[model samples]
Target chain A: MTTAKRDTYTPETLLTVAVQVFIERGYDGTSMEHLSKAAGISKSSIYHHVTGKEELLRRAVSRALDELFGILDEEHARVGSAAERLEYVVRRMVEVLMAELPYVTLLLRVRGNTGTERWALERRREFDHRVADLLRAAAAEGDVRSDVEVRLATRLVFGMINSIVEWYRPDGLDGRGGSGGAGEREVVDAVARLVFGGLRKAS
Target chain B: MTTAKRDTYTPETLLTVAVQVFIERGYDGTSMEHLSKAAGISKSSIYHHVTGKEELLRRAVSRALDELFGILDEEHARVGSAAERLEYVVRRMVEVLMAELPYVTLLLRVRGNTGTERWALERRREFDHRVADLLRAAAAEGDVRSDVEVRLATRLVFGMINSIVEWYRPDGLDGRGGSGGAGEREVVDAVARLVFGGLRKAS
Candidate 1:
């Protein structure tokens, strides 16, 4: 892979490369020097592409946050029954996560140590609140169980879904029998089944 | 906090210090110098207490693993109806996670970047597999729903339980009408409801 030749780099391309390094070495562990080495450019040249490491982090997280927030604005996600809307959001979340794997991975791993990280976290909380509202609506409609608090259920469901970044390797899934979106579809389907039908044998 | 000052540090003391730094800066981002400064000891003095950073990591993860594995071996977890045993393990896992919060947090965050990390990851996986087996047994007994894969259910449930570490603040819980462990109990209760009855309204 290292033997592959490289052409001129754009900010978009550099962002991708920098995000990979940030995820691997961690944001704090990485420096301009490391970014330069990874990008195959001088530190000064790298600086010309982006202001600094934090800027790269901000861009990466913003990309993820935008995609996530975009799900809520979709017509299917907005106009359906609460449960259906919830399912659409879940499926879209998985697709967005996979489509922007590296950026989303970086977004999930932020520790809130920097201003950019705090912003990312706050926006993430907003996304969760939006979903929680949908869950609450579903519960209110008597479509889903109301035994659990809306906030609590939302967090658990979000946890189940968001934990995908920890282990969902895109490379591993490509070799399997499904389409590009199959893994996301599987998770969305499984989550819906587990949420609605549960794990108990049918009576 | 630093101004309180201590002259001597034991393994327990050093671990408390190390865990704080690990949580703040992340395991891979933290170095011996960082540990030494945080612990208010020289780098060489840190070596005297623990062989190295990885030993500290190993000791930390080991303590967490012991607590988790102990939950599965407990009487409640071992001798009960499948559902009962499952609930017992779930509740106890939450309690263990809370009691061993910092240590378990460290263990969960390990990325398998080093030998110590790989060992922690492997043992943690073993613990997960052990729980998955119990979940499988419960499903085989016609307890859990058979529609979803046991492995996927196990991961999602574990994800729900482990995510408590991310947002749970003991102080915040205490400020509520509850004391310590209240948060964990709530999570356990929430998870049990979700896993057993699910989100669907009963017919």
Candidate 2:
């Protein structure tokens, strides 16, 4: 969370290295030895900064969860009509997913293999519930399509949003990679357009 | 591929067990010993059916890839307007993904850690490029919204499709799990609805 110099390798700096290793090797496959090798530090030094690999996963996932959970509390998400609020949440979620790409990538791949993973899954369900409510309200107001079930629509939208982590590369090498400062901006717009094509294009 | 009994443990039957363990423990985390135990057979028995863990992975991903590639050769995907062909591929893809859930699940999780995984990744990209052409043709024909970039739209659509592997458990124990006999049917419709809302719902 600190904006320390790039030279310093604090718990936060070490986390960037740890997360990359976790993503490269499956979380279960990754070890303190792997982290130490990737971080250019010793096993004892990694232990010095954090309890262990699980702790690193905990910290890394917490950062992603915090950023995601923060969106629900935003005034736009809280204040608008159900349909409007849904769009706001959808667009912001896209932006947040990109801004915190690596953390979010790790979050999406959690398979409930550990206590930290289980907890992350539970928290994610909580976030889904919050978004689902906005969508349900939108349906009730007839601002959203009624032909599709709200829960089904919500999961599909989440599917679309979460898919970003699977293929989106920051440097744009994948051809579809989110590159440049406008990359996230373009993603946000496209998601908003797809989710609410009727409402978005109408306006 | 055979409709044998649930009691007998053939190579195909044993594959189901291996795929589940791979999904639960992850491909890297799973071992031949783990597969033998989970399948209720000895490691030697597993070897008799197949070579080892990597072979199981190769088999599982091959099943997924073959089903997906088969879609393009179908009449619907081959002889239609670009938009229609794209729709056919998308709907059939959802069906294929649901039908081959376990196998596709393993395929999607392949991270190129082994030769099998790298092969799966390459095959998947080939499929993506094929779909990309359909989208591109549709865009040229002005069927889909050309306002969005084809490459970006293709990735998002694939993202949405690939996500079915994540939360779609047919039996529904996970409260958020996709269930009901109509689950795949609904998913097919929902994805179609989301992607080409204008082209699809209008009809």
Candidate 3:
């Protein structure tokens, strides 16, 4: 039976260790031994927290997907003009990516090797589709550029936003890529500016 | 000792298998035994083609970096106005990403787990630095936007372009994200359109 969650050995703490080990060694390469070693806990101790490595994977990806899908449910994401809403989602996505850096990083790297991975991929696609629909509406309303197709535009924008995971190293503070600035807000503002510049209709 | 190259187990043939396996199972997760099984050849036969899996990884990443670094040396990339050169580089990058999908995919995913990966990371930085210099020059000359920092702009654009690996499916033709009617060239044109829309100085 799974052990009851505790502050130190809680599923959340174990998830942090699992995500780090997974990213370092890759999801397929990592084992319970590796996670135990990295977590500085015994093998049985890890099982007490979660069912297995895949459980940790599921928890991490669920957090990332939840944040992403949650963006659409936000009033800002739902209530604005299509273009305005898309921009809000884009900005919030940058913020979410930075806030949930490791979880989102793992989410982006899932190759659909397992049931949890495939489920994560499906959820991500649903999120992308919802955003793509917003872009399509914006384009149809002539608020977004029509030269590029909506779906393609959506993919490219998603690509740019998702690519943040590859860089955007978050230290204690003073993030390096924010033009020597302190936090993710600067990066998000710049990305929003750049993305809207591309997507905006010619006035 | 490496065997003399043959048609069936030449470096290129093995490379094709290696990149596929690497993408599917990941590089670190893959072993020589896995490579042999994937290639449908004996382990000794696989060794005959290349020294080992690491060599294959090095060769694959080298091929990608070589193509990318080569773009900066072309006459179009060199002699044009900074904006024009940047545009040319952007278009060429899309073409190269399409033409060399798997190799570039592997190159983009290197995690610095091994010496070869660290070397690839360094080379990737050099390529990004060169592009950022071009963007900086464009901004200085009043040809590009001054609103976003050149480095951040560079990262996003690279992120957008480099992100094709995640979505691009190159089986025969009909690449999915390129829209229904266009080919790689059209996708490149659209990307160029979007990038310049963001970067170009306002009229």
Candidate 4:
């Protein structure tokens, strides 16, 4: 009975397990055997849920990509002034990154070794370009500093935002209680402040 | 004679090849055979230079870590007020990161998979703590904004600096000539500006 209960896995549950494994053992390093063992299911059971490992990768990155693309379609992202829209996107990106931490972590780590990975990279570039365009518009509007190139600034800001995947643990794995850890709201505000006002104390 | 010339590799040259392979295949996924094939040297030839794959990893990360730690020992990083020292360190970090691009790239990507990776991670945390301490001192001196926690701010800045490895190609692999890509001086200045004055146009 326990074996039956433990073995039952929905596609969503299976994907959650797969993403964790992918992050721990890089996607290229992970095989069907490894996934099966990590998921605690047979290879046949996994194949029944998804065609193969690549399908799981596709699904995982797709989910992350969908969440990110969805942010661009939000009303706040659509109607604001260029600088405002950029800020909104930056704030939302942090939230989405933290909310779907594992999936997005997998998405960011894809090295374009396979067809699905290449597709993910292309989409990521597309997203980066769209945000870059917003920064350009903000520069043209004289809202953002022009001394720094728009493409460069966009890349740096994205780097800061995306690096969250490397160290953030919602559970406060550092032995701190949850409240002691950086909360989502705190992170968003800190990023916004640093991106705009920077670390220098305002005179 | 041609084969003999092709197989020639010093430890430095071998490390360059190994770091490239590690970045491409990931450390865990890469085997000594893969390194041998990439370097065009036989496995026995590789053994003659290093004990094993872990030795190569240790050498690569050690080179990168030494560069980073060296930045803190500079006169500017040592003698200035907290804020000035922090700025100098930040600018130097960009220079060091770009100067030792491949090594730093491998260093940043280490995931504590081996004893060497775990050591690299520990040294990284120590480096981060040292920088964070500088920021804390700067905050105490009232030169840096205190509204944002020092730890969070330090992380975001480090993320921005470290992410350079993901896309920065000194050769301008995007087909742009070297001069057309972001120059070292340009990158250093931009990081300093964005890190201090930020993206908002100065009023």
Instruction: Pick the TM-score winner.
Output: 4
DockQ in order: 0.49, 0.34, 0.42, 0.74
Chain A TM-score vs. truth, each candidate:
0.88, 0.89, 0.89, 0.94
Which stretches of model 4 miss by more than 4 angstroms? Answer: A1-7, A174-180, B1-7, B175-180
Candidate 1 — what's its lDDT?
Answer: 0.80
Model 2 segments more than 4 A misplaced: A1-8, A174-182, A198-203, B1-9, B175-182, B198-203
CAPRI quality band, candidate 3: acceptable
Better of 1 and 3 by lDDT: 3
RMSD to native for every prediction? Answer: 3.9, 5.3, 4.7, 2.7
Q: Please write out the lDDT profile of model 3 over residues A1-203, one tens digit for every residue.
A: 55434336678878888999998878988989998778777888888888898889999999999998899999999897887888889899999999999999999989788999999988888898999899888877777777777677778888888888776777623333433443587789878877877522334
Per-residue alpha-carbon lDDT of candidate 1 for residues A65-170, written as tens digits (9 for 90 to 100)? 9999988989999897998898788778877887888988898888778999989988987898899899899988889888777877877777777776766666
Which 10-residue window of candidate 4 chain B scores lowest in summed lDDT? B171-180
List native contact recovery per candidate, as a fraction of 1: 0.67, 0.33, 0.45, 0.84
* Model 2 clashing-pair count: 0
Tens-digit lDDT string for candidate 4 (A1-203): 33522568989999999999998888988999999988888888899899999999999999999999999999999997999998999899999998999999999989888999999999998998899998999999999999998778888888889988877877756543222488889999999999989999999
Q: Model 3: runs farther than 4 Å from truth?
A: A1-7, A172-182, A198-203, B1-7, B172-182, B198-203
Model 4 scores a TM of 0.93
Candidate 2's TM-score? 0.87
Model 2 agreement with the true structure over B36-96: per-residue lDDT tens digits: 7787667777778787889888988999999999999999999978988998999999999
In terms of DockQ, the best-performing candidate is 4
Clashing pairs in 4: none
Better of 3 and 4 by lDDT: 4
Ranking by TM-score: 4, 1, 3, 2
2 against 4, candidate with superior lDDT: 4
